[model samples]
Target: MAEALPRRPPPPTIYRSAAGEAAIRALYDKALAALPYEHAERLVETSFGTAHVLVCGPADAPPGEPDQDAELDPAKHEYGKWALEVLRGLGLVPPANADGGKGTAPPPLHMGTSFGAAVVLDLANVAPEAIRGAALVAPGGLSAVNPWAFALRLMLPAVLYRLLPCSLTAWLSLVSVCDEPAAEELEVVLMGWKHIVRYPPLPGGPSGVFLPDQLSRLTAPTIIICGEHDIWPCKATAAAAAALPDCKTIIIPGAKHFPAKQHLIQAADWILDWFAVKGLVPAATK
Candidate 1:
């Protein structure tokens, strides 16, 4: 018998956006209208605040989740442990006989975009047995950040972000990481996450170093989808593909850094197709 997923919470409210709480509610309505009504949401309490996790799938099928930013959430602050929590949350348990004999159960699968993609890669390297498969979109951490830029983030005061106008900050970030011109809606959302709202500060924040050795440890099948126009060097992504034992890389034409947000349906289709090809979807769905 299949393990039952966590029960759905009463429909308190659905919140999905990078907007400030005041603006998020409004944007949430707009985003929700575009989704099927059957979609449900739950608020996962973390040390920082309540994280809104959206759920959509069959009752019998295993719970598959897309992670939010690992840097911001307490439960997922560490890239390594975050992956294990995601698997356990989805009810995946490591097989008792995993050392040599046939394993007891299949691992959970995960998908992520941008920084979340970095977390996916980190997790795959640290705990491959914890996941069945993984797909990453425009993943970072494959290459080190430019030294000048790395110093800027570390030296710049967090208060400066609070002081800067959201538009300017968002625009600067877009130009730095994205090759394509920013769409108005995308800019607005970026501004919301970067300036309008904030999370508790991280310790020392990220060092922005790309440690290639992490990729060498992955044991599960993986797929990496990178935007041809992304500011990060494509060669770095290629190097990551070369390092992994079971991996494939796809370069999407004309796409940029934030493909999941800018080209939502298109990006999701790629991920779902990979899952189907990998047989990551539950047998019931097949």
Candidate 2:
């Protein structure tokens, strides 16, 4: 008989101590408690694999697309598409003919941050009417990032510690991406990076996924929130934003890639304002 194949190793846990684990869990509990509406967690099966997603907002609220985060999954975009269908299956999305069963209205709004922002852009391009509006935070689709923003200083060391050093690489990359204010959350961000790089869904490398030329194909109202310092490819991101027919770009002064997370209230305000301006949010929400 043929030898049995080796089992794949389980992923690493972020916390090294029980106290740390309890603390993190407490933080999560607090966050969940703060949500305006009830939420559910489930495993969404996709062609790639099972994607764990948190569904929140009113149970009767209109269903929307999934917002991609900065996780390095090569199939991130594909997962977003699949997530839309899953939301529909869960009845989180309202019926298409909810208007007294008259006719189909616009789909629900979708949003994302950082790499997720890039995924939202790609989704808009792929399915113009799949969503109503798109909101991004420190999105990465802009092709014009400065070459120096790549954290080349840590490249050699990254290769040297290639066997196991995501935390170090993540720290180096964070240093390159953030400004002074981001220092307060540097440790949190470091742990986040460690989690991301530990068993990265996708290999680390440039996917060349975002194409500025394709921005024109998007018909949905799109917004981009970026940090002035996180400006990769120099002035290219601004230029690309300007090219989009219905795009609005906002640059946070003295901020970096993780501005939305660091400045949650500000980011939330910006998002609500954008939705109101686009007539996506209700008057009460304003």
Candidate 3:
């Protein structure tokens, strides 16, 4: 008999069912409705692809203060560069200095969480003068981890997600969240577990950590926040903050890799307070 070829694994996708996508959309809409500030959706063309951006806050507010989401591709730095270019083209952010010369124009502040935070750090390393400041929450790329162990840990949860009831799986996953998850949060988790085929791995196996020299080049003021119980990057984050020329570090109590909603709000307040102290933003009225 002729030799048979090995079967190829199917490609990864965000969701497995239309129902799951709808549930996610409903949750997003609910969150949007509850926002204290208004937001507008915009599509900006970039060299790589069209950028879908959400502009929040008042219409009269200053532009170029971009908030990056965790959904960005962290495996490469091109996406971050592309986003900056898009903002520059829109006149939201100042262009880079010419011929590697430093410009006197003020730069925009950036805030990012998880993989998005990694992107922010990469940008700061490559173009330090382009960023005024940064707020990184549970940032990645601070340390190296054993890929085998990481893969095994992820596989355990995925296997349980497939074998056990979704509620049970979600409850187990809650160990990473400090507070009881809201109904919407639970629903989102359940839907994700039920639908997602494969999860993407971090950029490097045991080599994602940025060199100390690279971090030393980040001259902008920065604040890094990590959950007290976040085993993945808590220590690494602190070490990174210590290495930076100007940096602040905060650890939220009783929080894990995924902090509670209230903790997130607290972190935001801290960032804003820090910015105010630095005169980057106006102080909140009591």
TM-score winner among the candidates? 3
TM-score per model over all chains = 0.63, 0.65, 0.76
Q: Residue by residue across 60-148, what tens digits does model 3's lDDT show?
A: 65453343322334445554565576566555566554353475346678887876676677776656776788888877766654355
Give the distance in Å from residue 268's predicted Cα in candidate 2 to where it truly belongs: 2.3
Candidate 2: stretches off by over 4 Å: 1-38, 62-105, 152-175, 179-209, 231-234, 260-263, 284-286
**For model 2, how does the per-residue alpha-carbon lDDT over 1-286 read when each residue is reduced to its tens digit?**
5233233233355455666666656655666686776677665443333455676677666533343222334444543454444444444444334442445445767787765666656656545556678787776666645555553633543453455555555456556555543443455554443333343332112553455556676667777777777745424677777767787878777776655455656777777787888888864443
- On lDDT, the leading prediction is 3
Full-model lDDT for every candidate: 0.57, 0.57, 0.65
Model 3, residue 196: C-alpha shift (Å): 2.9
- Runs in model 3 with CA error above 4 Å? 1-30, 33-36, 62-76, 95-105, 145-155, 199-206, 283-286
Which ranking of candidates, highest TM-score first? Answer: 3, 2, 1
* Winner by TM-score between candidate 3 and candidate 2: 3
What TM-score quantifies how close candidate 1 is to the native fold?
0.63
lDDT of 1 by residue, 1-286 (tens): 6343333233222334334455755665776677764666655432222345667787655554543333443233355554554454444655223353475576666676666666666666557677678777777767654446434432232334456745555455555445554565554545355434344322112544335566666656778888765655556776757777778888877666655454656666667777777777633342
